[model samples]
Target: MDVNRRNEMKKVIVSVKLRDILIGILIFNICIVIFSLIVVGVNKGNRQLKYGNTENKQIEHNNSKVDLDLKKEKDTILNKKIDSCINLYLTREKRIVKLDLEQYVLGVVSAEMPANFNIEALKAQAVAARTYAVCHTKHLVGGGCSLNANADICDSVHCQAYISQEKRMKTWPKKERAELYNKVKEAVESTRGQVLSYDGELVMNPYYFATSSGKTENSEEVFKESKPYLKSVESPGEEVAPKYKTQFKFSNANFTTVMNSQFKGLNLNSNIIKDKINILERSQGGSIKQIKIGNITTTGKMIRKLFGLPSANFTISFESTNIVFNCKGYGHGVGMSQWGAGVMAREGKKYDEILRHYYSGIEIKTLNYK
Candidate 1:
């Protein structure tokens, strides 16, 4: 009985030892799996952190670019404003007027064109006047138009007709002054910084006139230089001008004396004056190109100046004791016709259209000093 009991005890002890060994193996496998999971989780966290840093860098770079663009835009605008400011000389006052370029343009438009004209016409005038000022400023830099050496421009018809607000008020009716002033001011403000350009450059000469003689004249015909944009164009419906058809009469003796004195080489004989007068050539626009008086050939421009004629489009005839001059228009007939612009504006043309109608192949550009 003692041997049997000892065998049972030995069997129990072996079974218990086997069970402890199996538990130990299972615990080792579980520890291996836990270590692998921890390594994988740590790698994932590292990747996320790197990606987050890259994303933040991209956002910061985008923000920096936006700020740089805004700053550049602001600088450009500031430069433009500074460039637009020009110095003007009021010749009548004999003083320099430090006015904004747009304000000077306003004064020019008001004094140059009638305040009662169409809004579009007024805008066109404003652009033209501004362009004229810019061209003069450039000319001033190049040592041209030296009448006012210390000025960007002079305030005269020689440059551009300019009237101060105080003078304009004095000239206008007390009740209507405010309304007229506002009308001009609106036109200038609406077309601020606008100018006419040809071939990507500003036009040096922006000639304008009160009326055209049926058509506008070529620049070559009037100014001896052909400007492609100032080519002759039809300007109809200017018959409504107050002095469209003016008749000037002078005594034969007086006319002969004036002609003889004006024409440097001409010696006039009163008896043969009627026979010697001749219109040698006419421009395509029908203005007298050249005239022959006795032995001297002179331009119609000279004759117009000598006789105080309204325009070069005139027909001279000897009628008994007087020389009759039947004139058609009232200016140099070079570029923009104010009356034609008015008629076009009245007929529902915009300011740009009016400008294109008068100035051929031109671009209306806002002067960007930047």
Candidate 2:
């Protein structure tokens, strides 16, 4: 090689070594500083831990690690309440739950049905509801307390269910009921936030809101404490049939007024009437003849019943079995008829669409946990 090239190469090598040495020395100094800081901190922490003000001391968290372990303590507690729901996994292997945050939020807001539900199906339903709330709350799972097994889902506040062991199993399936319960419990814990929650409070969904004497549901005026406690039920019927098969004074007027609350003076539109008018006892009453809307004949017994009434004071449209003229407020005379939101989702209906319909002002989002 040439002398100039060799000199240049030698100079570059020397410069490189000098740079590395300087960098190494700087790194060593930083490490020493960090070590000294850590030792000083540890000494201070140990002193406080061993002889801190006794009166002001807390439960004596051994270390920062214990202070961050609130999630396990909470899980130990909630697990005890619902021991039957089916198990689910965050992944295919089933290491963690699939529905976490949804469970927590829902747990604080809902509760299980009567003890005769299909646990697996109930768990699936809880997952779906979690899917719904996850969207609405804008919160995801697997983020520690932000989303964990600290929540309860598969509850009645979000959906109605039978309560009381005997009453629940009376008509529900045996195998299916157990399966649903077990599946739900597992699914709820497998994922993050699978229960009802609101603000900072962990709302335990008190099932079955009570109403007036014969009326069990008056959403606005619920029997706060009498909430249902059972877990799941395999079968659910259209509104539980009245105890007495035959009514002593059954009339369309009474059905619309007392049962449904419909009348000409009601001034409610066709949509409102449709929302509230349900046939709870179709197989056990007289047939309704006709109904008129502004002198126009509407379809079925609806229009006919409207024609005869004084518009303000309702009258019995009919009364008998096989075609019970039941004038109920709301179409799905069954469970949790969303006469309110049902009027909305119909403009465009999807599964999520139906969810937003019943649950007031909520969103729809999917789950993703790592």
Candidate 3:
């Protein structure tokens, strides 16, 4: 029965066992591959769901953060290109001090606009002040302070008001100084190296004032020069400003004396002042343009300066023995009104939106030195 039959059987048994083991290994390998494919598919779907639809993809919140970071980085690079110094003349100190342009912008923003204003409004003011400084930079643009040839600008309202950080700290209450300064600094830094330009040229005159009489004046009406961007525009929601409406009263004798002193050869009777004074022409923004008094035609601006009035948008009224001038708004009423900007900011307008509203046909461009 025998050795050959036994050896054949043993070989058959071994071959069958080997085939079973091979099949089992193949099945295990297939299961491993299938499990990996399933895991990968699940991960892909989760990624898609987290990101958004593939056809119309939406950014995740983190993506927005990344975009903001990139924008900040870009702004940092732009600011680095313009890290130049400015020579600012201190009018009270009668000295010229040089500082970084961005720092100067910070000072100007802190000085020109109230620190408690909305951040967007402060940003708008920062850009405007930066534009003014860059436009008047002596070496950069061939413009300088008229009073001081050695200085690029003066810390006077005639230019753009600027106060050092030390001075600003002193001006504000002790508890509010640090917070206010940080707010101003954030505004300037957020808009670093940005300026307003009209038709590819920097805005030469970015004039702004405290308030307006419902609307801003045209450049031609206020400065006698036509500026396309500085046209008449409505400035609403400024009635809440402190200087919205003011009054100046002068006795008939005092009024007559003041008028006669400015307009020589004019003899006016105090009793008939109301009848003799007449407003002949008014600007589109309701600012008095021309007025005649005792056969003398004078400009409203001249009268405003002579009498130290807040603005030229005034109405005349006779009160017993006194001549009363009711003035609406303040400053020159030719550009962006600070109070108006605050209103816009409160209504959720962005800084660029506020700037574009006041300065028409302008672009907010990043400064490039090269």
Model 2, residue 72: displacement in angstroms?
A: 35
Q: Per-residue lDDT tens digits of candidate 3, residues 242-272? A: 9999999989999899888877889999988
- TM, every model: 0.75, 0.26, 0.77
Error of 2 at 176 (Å): 17
Model 3 regions lying over 4 Å from their true place: 1-83
Report the lDDT tens digits of candidate 2 across residue range 191-237: 44343322222223322221111211312222223222211111122
Which scores better on TM-score, 1 or 2? 1
What lDDT would candidate 3 get against the real structure?
Answer: 0.89
Q: What overall lDDT, based on C-alpha atoms, would model 1 receive against the true structure? A: 0.83
Best candidate, TM-score-wise? 3
- For each candidate, the alpha-carbon lDDT, in order, equals 0.83, 0.35, 0.89
Ranking by lDDT: 3, 1, 2
**What's the true lDDT of residue 329 in model 3?**
92
Number of the predicted model whose lDDT against the real structure is largest: 3
Q: Can you write out model 1's per-residue Cα lDDT over 255-353, one digit (the tens) per residue?
A: 889888876768887777888889999887778999988998888888898889999999988788888999998999988999999989999999999
Clashes of 1: 0
Better of 1 and 2 by lDDT: 1
Q: lDDT of model 1 at residue 301?
A: 86
